[model samples]
Target: MSRILIVDDEPHLRLLYETELRRAGFETMTASNAVQGLEFVETMEPDLVILDIRMAGMDGIEAMQHIMERDQRVPVILNTAFSSYKDNYLTWAADAYLTKSSDVTELVETVKQVLEKQATAHG
Candidate 1:
């Protein structure tokens, strides 16, 4: 099973994503902020990351830069409540980008697609 690290400031989102991803047969980990998420990226070495653009301390864009520097191979999915971030060029570094919604079906599908694409690229 693929391990996914979900980085978001919202506690509810973290739990929601974790529950849904687990149901999708994935191993999930949650980090409340970009700082913790970065640590998980280095220590846990998750197969994929679902990152939120806006957080308390370091934003996801900066965090994504650090994550890529540490390991470019790990794919990141930018999940944000604000669609405006998509216009920013920095977000392009992520493997996938999606606006947040109450329904998690899109999130789950995107996760599978990103993971599959990463697997293909690595192989």
Candidate 2:
């Protein structure tokens, strides 16, 4: 099973994502902030990372930079409430950028697509 790390400041959002992704058959990990998320990247080495752009401290853009520096192969999805970050070059480091929504259909589809692409490339 593919492991995905979800980094978001909102506890409810994290829980929602975790429940949905798990139901989709993904092994999920949760981190409340970028710092913890990065640590998970180093230790857990998740297949993909779902990140929120706006957080308490190190934002998703910054986290993407650090994550890429560590392992460019790991695909990151910049899941944010704001779409303006899409214009920022820093966010380009991520494989995908998604606007947050209460409905997680898009999020689930994107995760499947990215993970499939990764598997194909590495296969």
Candidate 3:
């Protein structure tokens, strides 16, 4: 089973994403901030990460830089409410950038695709 880490400040959004991803057959873990997210990445080493940009402290882009420094192999999906960050050069490091939505269909699909692609590349 592929384990995915969800990094977001919003508890409800985390739960929603966790539930949706779990239903899609991916194991999910969540962190409320970038610090926790990076710690989980170091300790748990999830297959992929769904990161939110506009958090309380140490935004997703900054956390992503740290995560990449630790393990570039772990793919990151930037899950932000703002589309403006898509133009930000820092977001380029993310494997994919997804704008948050009430419907998580696209998010789930992106997760599957990224995990599958990364698996194929590694194998």
lDDT per residue as tens, model 1, 1-123: 999999999999999999999999999999999999999998999999999999989999999989888735788999999999989999998999999999999999999999888888779
* CA lDDT, candidate 2, residue 113: 98
Model 3: per-residue Cα lDDT over 6-118, one tens digit each: 99999999999999999999999999999999999989989999999999979999998998887356899999999999899999889999999999999999999998899
For residue 3, what is the lDDT in candidate 3? 97
Computed on alpha carbons, the lDDT of every model, listed in order, comes to 0.93, 0.92, 0.93
**Model 1 residue 45 distance off true place after TM-score fit, in angstroms:** 0.8
Put down candidate 2 lDDT per residue, 2-38, tens digits, no spaces. 9999999999999999999999999999999999999
Winner on TM-score between 2 and 3 is 3
Worst 10 residues of 1 by lDDT: 65-74
Q: How large an RMSD does model 2 have?
A: 1.0
Compare candidates 1 and 2 on lDDT and give the better one: 1
Candidate 2 stretches greater than 4 Å from native = none
Task: Give the range of the ten consecutive residues with the poorest summed lDDT in model 3.
Answer: 65-74
The clash count of every prediction, one per candidate, is: 0, 0, 0
